[model samples]
Target: MTCLTDGEPSATADTDTDTDTEGELLLRVLTAFLREDVSGWRTRSTPVRRGDGLWLRLPVATRERSRGAALLMPVLDDGYQSTYAARLPLLRREPGGAEFVDTAGVLAALRDLADPVDRGGFEAFAVECQQELDALRLHAGTRREVESLLSERYGVDPGSWTGLAGGLGYDTLAARADHPVYPTSRGRSGLGIAQLRSYAPEFHPTFALRQLALPREAVTVGGGTESWLSPRAAGAPALEGSHLVLPVHPLTADGPLRDALRTAGLEGRAYLVDCPGPDVVPTLSMRTVALASDPTRHLKLPLATATLGLRNRRTIKPGTLTDGAAGQRLVEAVVDREPRFRGVILHADETRFAHAGHELIAVLLRRYPAGLEDAVVVPMAALMCPAPGGDRLLIDHLADRFHDGDTLALLDATLALLFDWQTTLFAHGIALESHQQNISLVLDHPAGGGGSGGGAGRTRLRLLFKDNDGPRVNLARLRDVMGQQAPARTEFDDRRIFVDGDRPVLDVFTTITLHLCAGSYAFGLARHGHAPLERLLRLVRERLAEAVERLGTAPGEPGALLRAHVLDAPELPVKAMVTAGTLLSKERSGAADINKHYTTGPNYLRHDHPRQNYPRRNYTRPTGTS
Candidate 1:
């Protein structure tokens, strides 16, 4: 059997030029800053009238505020920067006026800012953020080096390389893996630069998994079937009694996990089997790995890393596995019951294994949607990733499929599917966290081949959801819809689903899926001059209107209530990451408390103010009727 430390280098050799590495570091920091700004974490003065656009002002004295403003200077377009600079009296008093505070100047200003005693946690967060930035920069350099090495050895351009002839390629996966906005949000805190390169999807490294045998008594297993537990034994002896096979990521195997196994008295009882087949490829989520031989089956493993301010460890509590199993059943029932949601694939957890009360060794086995083998499946984030050796976004690759390369048509198609799928799920009492990474898009020619090369009908787009852990159901409403069979409680009974209001459900779905996912994508398109942000939002509104009509809700049904909420709500609740970070620091909370942080923000979808004599319906009515 191959040991965890066998045949691997301890540290990566540094070959990157200092300038390039520093530039990459700056990009990572700026991306995080941009996320905070767009998410409404930073405060800005009211817009003042400018030449063509409105001008925003930032208080120069507030060093905390200035840090975000300064970072924004580098990534934002000239027009945006100018708008922020215009009419700022403080900047006007500085040398060379506002124009002098360029990207470099902003960086310099940030360096001069001092940390306050009250912001000790923020100071620590800043250090971690910088470390993550440095790690990502190193990862990027390693990718380039690997690309060059492969190119020279294989006599082909690796950057433009495609995988398996006509199938989906690694290029798309690689591009999407390195998140454009927050690449280091999921940095492995304890990992060195070389280990980060080894495990991170951006570097495109693959390695064999280490296997362990857990006696049936020591592990709590939940799934539809036991067959899912089959493992590639790789010469390891079979257990004398009932045992569940667990395949662990190599990094986890070397750390605390190995020590845990030894402490559990599994050293002699469990065989340390080598993975015999192909290596596992990490996906956009560093913890989830897909088998190289079979892409359809993915194994979600716990890792000792943190991303987006949440630790990567999956095993936290005991009831979570039970909740996951129950949630899967509930989602499967929804898909079967709703015809509009038939195409919405929930990559349900087929199996789960964990020691009761000990979540350190937890693992979930999930399968790709059935009958989608030929479809070009990619994470929604891939649409925003830059194409190979070009500034063009990956969505540009699908331009030929639409009429005159109309991006609006593509947006329309995608939004329509999203609206239908999400609305149906909401109506059935499930709120999906359909963020870009959790959701995937499957693009293909329409099922019977009717359209020409340049038309709206040429290609079809379908939405597939992963990470079933995100679906939350309102048990009260769920029982109203599903009758006696509906589950009254699950592991996530308190946290996952809203217990009282439809507005909270709508808020969660809209914040994560609409505002964050669609809004970010629209902003990216607008930033690149691909499409107008207003037009995209209008399309979203139109699609929501259609979804309401499609569901044919009466005046007071959940469907109608959600539709009204989407169309008429004055503001939506947006999860405040910065506030959450502060709360996390102050409370010293664990990762489970991450979702509890939210603050209200303006609803971009609602363009019209309330008018007298307009119909108002109660949102508190029971599920089905007016």
Candidate 2:
């Protein structure tokens, strides 16, 4: 059923003796078998041999222009013989063994490398055209039609308060005319409300939410645009939401997060916010709806993990795409492109809070349920997934987030943790793309743990990673619809409607990663680049003897440490945003007092780019879905 390999399979010459980084060797090996250019390509190898000398194989979807990429899955022993007899190949082999194509063919052979030795004491060896029953039975339903049915089954107005339009079955990422964010009785339409404060500077966000602030005026910015923000938990002094823009360096004692919280008077009561509106009054504080719960709250992402096979890459609509492949590109920026990076952790059910105004900072997660520090990872589920579009970062190292081990230290100390993080991530074979916007750095009193006392009340890093919404499950999956093994299937490949290039990886990352990582890297270059980048470069230095230092220290799972930095948010202009902003300001001040405006600290930039026309669709054949 695959659209690849017409008629009899084509042949290729044997060319395997190449000396290079495992990355290169793997690519050549993968290429020989895959037999076509791959997109969202990823490579992983053991830092050193372990256990029965086995290497874990992982992959995401295949977004390439040719062939269908599927996570060539792993199967052991004679089990695959039957699958292959039915034409399923596990493409695998020994460390110094032969290779071939077809998922089953490749993986089955690779697993055999770990097989037990013969009675003579040498590794068992032999290749057999083992065949099994010609009938394994095909499923009754066509996989592609499932999404169509799910969308129809749900129907609009299935109406749970939690339900909202996120393009699940709409066939487009950004809304279209019939789609309902805005009703046009007009020519050009805007998706979000323009900031009312831009015009009505005196307006304040409001709603009865206790411990919150609201714009005073009833004016709505940009048509019906509404934004929400939460003040820091440590407390603020101001008691009014006076259209104020506090300086990051602060010209006064009270800081923004604290000031915003105080002005909103949220220190006292709890308020519920489940309103209806194009502009329901703003709720500038945590809601009684509950913040972090005793039970971990979770938010599933719109992104799917790395999948294989060429997804329907024909640009079908006008908004940024939000499938697993797009997410994989984001992840690659974080895991493969140098410095290590991990993604954000959503509150048990806090996917909504992660992206709402003021709720985006990692500092907010500092309010985790009391005893959950040691329980670093939490899975919170919700109706909507909120991973910012693209890999671009908009960091908010809130001024209130400046204590000892707080956000500040997490930034500086990011270097010391990359070793375990990068290796763990490559193992997953897909990056988590845990950029700052998606994650939080919580600071609390140390009931116990190392440097517990010193970082107490400041910040003791417990790096968190989540968001299955946008995963590049594994490299193999990117080549084809990785069957049913993907970590999570997407609600829809709605984001593809917006991707513009022949390959989704380049376009998505160019926009998202450039935006996010540019800022982070700039922060580092401005702050401490040598350390973070070197963390990886050093691990991968001259002879890699560096890994020898800690023979047994790799984290159990890839992305285990999930440190979100340049490697984690590479598409970002990690070094550029900081650079551009600096360039702009220098010109503004004529370079007279440049140092006054610039700093090693990452300045938060959170501008929400609205959705536009669905780029023209560029269709290839209907290969298969990832």
Candidate 3:
């Protein structure tokens, strides 16, 4: 049963509201500032005598504005400050009064708090934040209308949609959700309001894919795509002499790709096709889209937009296609060898595609395996989004279908599957960037073959993973498992993918999987009163302990290090997403890769407090395993 009452509000209410931008933005910035302990916030800030919850007065050195203080709610698994503490004012200390501050004021205070001030970075970040707020406000009304429509169409009668269509529908809902940590995630730099509606998934726009014809000798081709680019397909234009067809995103065809052709002196040789290709709709990733006629075939094209940060452009770099395919091959080999992972782990066939060896011009086709028309696939990010009308979460619908509305049980089952797969991969020396957006949960039709949505209670859970370009690999450990002669390989064009130490592996596991995927849910559920934060965190630890026992926690083993780093450590690593993703340059941030910078945060799994002394279990190998 769902723990929330009919009148109760959703955990995401603060972030989803049409107005109240200031309050939501304040919470987002404050949570990041405090959780990251930016400029020694934890050590320097003093606690206030608040009656309801913990509040702190931050010492921001600013002459233009008054001092600011924030109210924080601590999560139990990781010390991430809660982002849903709504109606809590960021108080400004004035001579005769204290009043709430605007979002700009709050950001300005935060900018002042930084040591060796980064005025330029903070100013740019502020601009993005305003852009994000505008976009969020612009989307607010349309988002509700879309959610209502989806609820009426699918939520009431899910059987109407096939599994793939339903998955894309859920992806549209997920597109409305914000990133857990990044405050300016909604900021799509270089995109105007019209472009947002035209190209963004949240708008649910369906437009025809554009095409360009390049010289046959000037392009690089990967897998076979003759059928996709043939003259007879989708009324494609007849190719000129010695030319190959290239599918391009509508946004890129007229913008950066056109510029790229001119820069490469191929404008005369290569020309844009006047006729449109197949109709396609954007997915959660924005750049990747599925065909309107055949949902199974997806095209991942390079778009000329920036999300997350100005520096993070959505373009495919040279060699990215081959490297992504290689990563997929490595993971597929591991799954084939491990009996527990055989049927439950799935991959999209990304071996077919072509690019012009430029970031601005490329396309990768991802083909889903056949026979998914009768399953329910939901992205992990969509699970927590408020269902239509904001009464309960979308996960409640699944809970009602499978667990008799037992949301806690659904969460438990999900956590079990996640830890089992993640820790097993860790043991095998692979660290997937399994963020909520990249991974989706596929619920198979119940035994006896019923409709995709309405089925028996007992359905199988499988994970569908895509975007294989970001996983980190411990090459030496993988060699031990696959043997030196095995064809499985982790070699990629990106140097950051290979790591020789346990720290990098642990960093990815804890930050992406544990914090973003698991902890985000736990904290969200607790905020909605589904379960206590401690109880949910205990469930996570228990599941992790079980995985550790199965992997065998002997000294110098993977499990031993995993256990020590995740469970027994005093602090866990958290990605400084705002810092590295947007705020600072590589020189200023001192980060080699923009995505890899981290800061140590308090570990909630450890119980060193005087009141609590949870017993640690002795981990040993399970019999007949390994």
Candidate 4:
């Protein structure tokens, strides 16, 4: 096994193969359909008797359509047939009933669906989806290999290593990056398999960053204090003169940016000077790389990869860089002022820069919290990831702390922290897109011991948020809270800080945090038989209600509006990626408005029964042989 440390580069080896096979393409489409909820399919189960043993048979279904083309007609009606047609075999019709289908019968049915005449204009989308799916599967295989290799190299059982190794963070992050719960784009990365292995965090790939030293006047720097950049300059002596050193991703050095660097009057033939410090590895967010020497400082470099259903170029919009800086300052101020919010830390983007007309070179700098070294920070998405060498979920590792492996206890601790964070942000009129990737849980084990022992006492779980660019602030609330402390620029045009309407601003936070973050986790846990979906939803409602009651104390408090919206509103705004993709397909000009696409759906919190009706149950061990 290859042993690579942070700030050290591994020799590149070619492992490329043709990934665009028919079976692989079909799997990708099936995964995406299951993940994005494109046709509103739900997993339903029926009891079946087989030879004297009774079994619960679960099948995927949609309203009015259960099997055959009928089951997929709704998706086709939505103009996604081209994207889904290749994967139809995966949903084979049952012998007698049209409802239950054979999900495992995909390979045999691959050739059954030839180029159908009905798929007229969507042929291109279908092709792209298939290609992307194939690429995704290839990456998934690489991820599995990386995990297995890391487990073996460390001489620890897969998924059981609890030490705070620098490599462990990237290993777990890479494992979580697979986003196993959602089938869509499973393991599908924007970079190819070989590039993924070389540069992606999952593969534990590390390489020295190529540096570009440009005259200070050639680039525009914004949003950072002079002290922040001073430390960064110490590592690069090439920038000794008044030049600023910018780190470039290794892949970017070999790609389109090469020409741009040459034009900018760089020395080397490759147009990038090799920086001498430690190599950095990419995180779950492909663009953000953490230093091997110092885990606290993370450098966000520009990599044009189409992952998570969006193509990110790492470039900040015209004035948004300054806006991000101001937002960070405001959040810091709020955190300092509010005691309840002090637990949550927003990893602000301290600095942002772009070379003149070279937005591709833009980078954002962020620092992890100081004095929290022992804490194990895991992305929320990784909690449900399958543990290596065991059927249990990765989150199950924390179960030793709870009574009788009661996962609900863990859920409660996480929710309590999330409530404090969310409520504080809401009260301040700031909405964060706290999805699984953007949010991390800092699990502070008890002081005296480690792992299970750490859980014996109260385990403190706090929320740490990154990517400060997306938070939407309400100008009205800012003025009320900050008073004279508000930035002077806010007086001229509130548009810089505040979004247009109150509801939209609130929607950005609620939809992503509540629906995408909590909702997705509930479904994932239920899928793995760890906990019932309703149980988790009920817990969420209870926590929200408690928060509402506590915040409702002061008259004119924003909590009242939030309370009503969460409890009484019939539907909650959901960012529907498939619906958004369809809308983007219709546009003939300019870049797609990927962020604006939203669809309202039934709120899970609103229930007909009184809150007390669903009494909390004791932490009984899950059913099966003890």
Candidate 5:
């Protein structure tokens, strides 16, 4: 097989905590720990409102009342009311008085106060956080180079490139930003600095895939790979038996796949091909790579790295390939039948590939439909991420370019389109994990009439969704909407995708779609002084109410329950991402699905508190600190 080559020149360390990158990892983690209260930290702590923001006086169990840690948080305006600013530090209070602590001090204090059961996990996470910080520092120079390239290439018009190029460009931009919740998002647990430089998207690495020859009889196969597979690209091997070629990630080829092949006693049946296969570049999700020859075609391969959490592997499970395709078909049926979704929502075709029933040996092909070459496709996450210059946000650039410099109008249009599709899907018994990363906005001017920051009124918007393996689908209701002959009747290998009750369905919608996707941008925009958090949330509530009303409010139905739980309830369900994704095990957390573990958080959508959003400023300071 092809040897792993260093894909790009390594970048040097460059960091500025004030504008970009992990200046606030420790504080962000602590804020989430308290807000989720997964370990009884919030109830024990006292909250003090300092100016517009809220500060948590954390109890130091080892110290007397005179000594404690106080963390300032950015007040949110939607469901899951608490959040932290990445630009802010932490405050340490003691008998000698309160002063801001450095990153190391925050980590030591957190370690000192952590519970015995959670201490190990917390320490592991802390290590990952530091690694993530270091990685970002190394990535800082390369990130600026990428921004410069895109800026110089695109000039004042972002839509100048084809849809696929624009989408890939925006994906690179999104990769540079920190995750709103996962504090150690950039940490690649199994990879060293060199490996990260070769494979990670932030580095913009392009490398060839390693090929393996597997006996046709020994592996389970799905969609066809004949059209793209070639002698020049994937080595035309003269095998003695009937064998099929499987494209493997260069990294996975060296680690898990070799071991798995040996364990399965297929040493003689499958052999590695000594050829550099189709050159590919990584997307935001490192495991899924885009073909360098034709980026429209993406290959999802198994990887040994862990991101988001130490326990969360990047390997592609055997069932995931088919299960994800099945979910895509079901969603396709919904989009086809729903008149409102016509020309408004599009899905990536993920129906082809082959698998050996092993996580490391599976491949799923992602094909993008035509017509994207003309529009600008950007993931929702990229809009709010820190911009390339480290001065203005990405949304600022988009707003100034496409929306006539009106950020509020751009956000309003986005929310209107998002709610229309998402709410309708919920009404039809499908709740997708349409977080910012999974969803993209397709924007184009009517009849190609607008450009150079002049297309404000005629801009048309659509939603493009991908990664459909984890949605909660009401099978019976889906079949009703799609009819008996529709593909909605397809069975999935992952039964977690099928939900029997409304609670589970609503949980996915509330936690992922509303809180993570919608609420995240709302908070980001508010924190950046784009608009009042309450005003944006009021728009959210109104849009949600309109969707519910449009869907019919039959009592106890999905729409009715969604309105009640999200708009009226004081506490809303939120995924305990840190606990489930990193700190705890299934047995200890008692989580049926580690990704779905839930906890109650304050619902800021409640109409009772109609106030102005907090002004943008440093939140780490004490009540009266100058």
Candidate 6:
């Protein structure tokens, strides 16, 4: 036996809010999608004619609100038939930049400014709201009542959202919308979020939805190629656009989640990666794949050769990457260049990655992979996860101990494998939607991959990774991707999004610990601890020092990139970062926010090579069910 697993749980602290590495990264990318003019909030004495209808961006808020909080506030009026509210919270700013709710006070102020006609419209709208509520056939009362109605009214599913809403005692929907103490672009939209959360939800046509909300026009009756969880069912119909998969519940709090799930958990990957596929986007591909075998088989292609976001759905949606020729073009580009870049894992088909630069990103990766990369290719259609093994709870292999060392060594190997798979996203302007289920564990014999000396020289062995099909990388997470600026490296900033929360240095640390260290733990803590943060930092320090010594002061992007690695020492200046880890052996429940993303254990093993015979998670959903 390599090493015994560490059943001990880590200690944790109350963090009303934990820093979201990916959310910060995405802030940079989202800006490109839509820009908000801060000037809109100010009273322009000139009051130049604004957009014809009151331009509504965000709801009026003042307090901290959770799912369905919008329903609580009275919809106020402006001069236009439609009221105008900007996305920005109306009143005060919340800490951590949560979206502030536009409060009644803000509405009153807007109402006062509006021409009487618009004000009348607001009043009329408010009146209609009551009628709408009275007619709610599913209104059972309490937050739970509202939640039930949501599932009934809208085919939403229950997952981690349930736990979140459950924590709030939100059986009834709030009458008003509260201001986001800190608005999260990373958060879900309107009732869509609530529906998945506390209750079944309904969408008022007027409510503007954000990313991840179920689209009004998604779903097809028997049109999509459906398979069944049971043998008897055929493809009944596929929900149009991105269908709801399991709540990307992952192991958020390392200490507790790990103990509960008994897997190292995918929390680190969750914060470190964005999903890699495009969301409800259009694929301009010209290739015409057979509707039936086309999508399924296409999805099976090697990661280096396919677009992950675009699934073979019975129906299609806008903003989602399309399946066919255009995607083929991008896929072909990356595949062709694989050798040039040493090795590459390409994920383009998933709907979540719509905004990740399609071809351009491919080109950029083609360049970098050629320069620096320890490559491995996993052709798996597993559940969404970050760490490599989370795709499968490959327990079968864990029991087999054919070698020496310990589980810690096995875990390190596991992490290195997952990191490489996930890092591909950053190369392509995408993020790995690495929750737990997304990874898989595999057994690899070094000789099987092509012989003893592994890595770039040979296949080394197969490591687990999900086949492309999960959430797309939110283009918005560029901020977190470009952690701490590299003083001397201009190249480091080339792909970096300066705005939002882009911080590449921190991202690296997250990747190594969460993804790498977790794998180590699986084998046992002993082997994994060898590559402790201090040791890793030392390695980086040595690399940087050597580079500077030889080059006599680094220059440009190369210098910056190197500087970022050194600066991204596991020990960062942020107090929030200091608390990333908790004490070991503490028995506790995982945090409400982070608990859902726990990775399954079987997919990886500490010190164990990737397991081979353990590929599964490729189960096609049963037909006729949401």
Per-residue error for 80 in candidate 1, Å, reads 13
In Å, residue 524's CA in model 5 sits off its true spot by 1.1
Candidate 1 off by > 4 Å: 1-118, 139-186, 227-234, 238-242, 262-271, 274-278, 310-318, 344-357, 401-404, 450-458, 491-498, 551-555, 581-583, 586-592, 608-626
List the candidates' TM-scores in order: 0.75, 0.27, 0.87, 0.73, 0.87, 0.28
Summarize candidate 4's per-residue lDDT along 145-174 as a digit string, tens digits: 655766675534322343224324434444
RMSD of each: 9.3, 26.5, 8.1, 8.8, 4.9, 22.4
The lDDT ranking, best first, is 3, 5, 1, 4, 6, 2
Each prediction's whole-model lDDT (CA): 0.54, 0.24, 0.70, 0.53, 0.69, 0.24
Tell me how far the alpha carbon of residue 118 in candidate 1 is from the true structure, in angstroms, after superposition.
Answer: 5.4
Please give the TM-score that candidate 3 achieves against the real structure.
0.87
lDDT per residue for candidate 6 within 529-549, as digits (tens), equals 333333333333343334333
lDDT of 2 by residue, 225-309 (tens): 1223322221332423532111111101112335433443432321212221111121111111111122232211111101111
The 10-residue segment of model 2 with minimum total lDDT is 131-140
Per-residue lDDT over 298-403 for candidate 1, one digit per residue giving the tens place of the 0 to 100 score: 7777776665553333443455556666667777787778775666554545445454234557677766666666445666766655444444555665554443
* Clashing residue pairs, backbone N/CA/C < 3 A, model 3: 1-405, 1-406
lDDT of 2 at 214: 33
Off by over 4 Å in 4: 1-124, 139-144, 152-183, 186-190, 223-239, 259-271, 274-277, 310-320, 343-357, 401-404, 446-454, 488-497, 553-557, 581-593, 609-626
Worst 10 residues of 1 by lDDT: 617-626
lDDT of 6: 0.24
TM-score of 1: 0.75
In terms of lDDT, model 2 sits at 0.24
Say which prediction, candidate 2 or candidate 4, comes out ahead on lDDT: 4
Residue 604 displacement (Å), model 4 = 1.6
Residue 316 in candidate 2 has what lDDT?
11
